[model samples]
Target: MAHETPRHWDRNMRERLRRGEAAALAELYDRFASLAYGIAQRVLDDEAATGAVTREVFGAIWESPERFDPRQGTMRAWIAGQAHQLAVARLRERAAGPAVREQVAAAATAARADYIVTAMPAPLREALELTRFQRQDYRQMAERLGINEDEARRRLRLGLQLLSSAAQYGAESADPTGGRPAPPRELGSR
Candidate 1:
């Protein structure tokens, strides 16, 4: 059978799905599951979470095909949007109750920190890791690394400067539209 393009096939599939045709749902899954999974993975960054989000999206479509209105957008866009939302919701849920919003902020900060730390020179990386991760004070770090205390402080300062610059660059490049951040989801509300 020659399959129609998604633009046309989605319309027919939606109707079949609404009529409770199982094969239609399977066809839709076969067509869009990878796209949905990619969106979920990009948003959630965890394989288990991505799987959950993808399954939730397909289940929602199966249960309520009417929720997808053709006038609003193409079926692909609709599914991708749903995947993004579900992935974000799962992230918020993982943050635990009232701290959902804080979790997002913390995750972004952690991600940026990781990127900067990974990019640092070996000496700077060692200095920062000793102080931050190992809870070593300047004197202890200097003794451990066989450097003077002033040199240890200098390395830490340089590492922080690099991190700050990288973070600024990241923020500038993040969204070209200068739009506000996505609204945070309430924990357990989804």
Candidate 2:
């Protein structure tokens, strides 16, 4: 069999693809899968993400073969472009994962802090609200509440101590160790 030139091969494949022939897609995959995978792997670096990008590019080609205009570029270039775009999109999502998680963690921590503050005794809660939440200095809090500076300072300290204890309690309770101090082991124990 005579080997067809690249241009003739691409043109014939495109025509078959436009006719919705599965063989055309198979030929295209056979020709370009490695190129697509290479481009995706370069951009994504991870095996799983690279595989996904390669599959998505071919899937898009399979679904919309007529979208490829012979006048615009060669099939190889088009497939590489598709792979690069998909890989970059996946990379962007992976890059943003940590930031999204941080935002969620900050929101959860704020909610937990709010719950602890609300459950406090009134005086401690009031002092924390004014000093910590409202960003008030001790003297300002004292003046606002019509109390002396010493009392304001004491309330703020006690509030901080209670908050610390609550956080520690939460940590201990959630620990797999069941909030108990580690037991002393016998010398002969495995």
lDDT assessment of candidate 1: 0.80
lDDT of each residue in 83-175, candidate 2, tens digit only: 998999888878877566455545544655566677667877788889877999999999999999998998888777655554444444344
Best by lDDT: 1
Give all candidate RMSDs, comma-separated: 14.8, 14.3
* Candidate 2 segments whose C-alpha is farther than 4 A from its true place: 1-3, 98-190
Q: Over the stretch 1-190, how does candidate 1's per-residue lDDT look in tens digits?
A: 8878766776887899999999988888998999999999998889988998999999999999999987787999999999999998777777666464455455666686687678667888999899889999989999999999998998988877766654454444444355554332321121
Query: Each prediction's TM-score against the native?
Result: 0.49, 0.50
Worst 10 residues of 1 by lDDT: 181-190
Kindly state the number of residue pairs that clash in model 2.
0
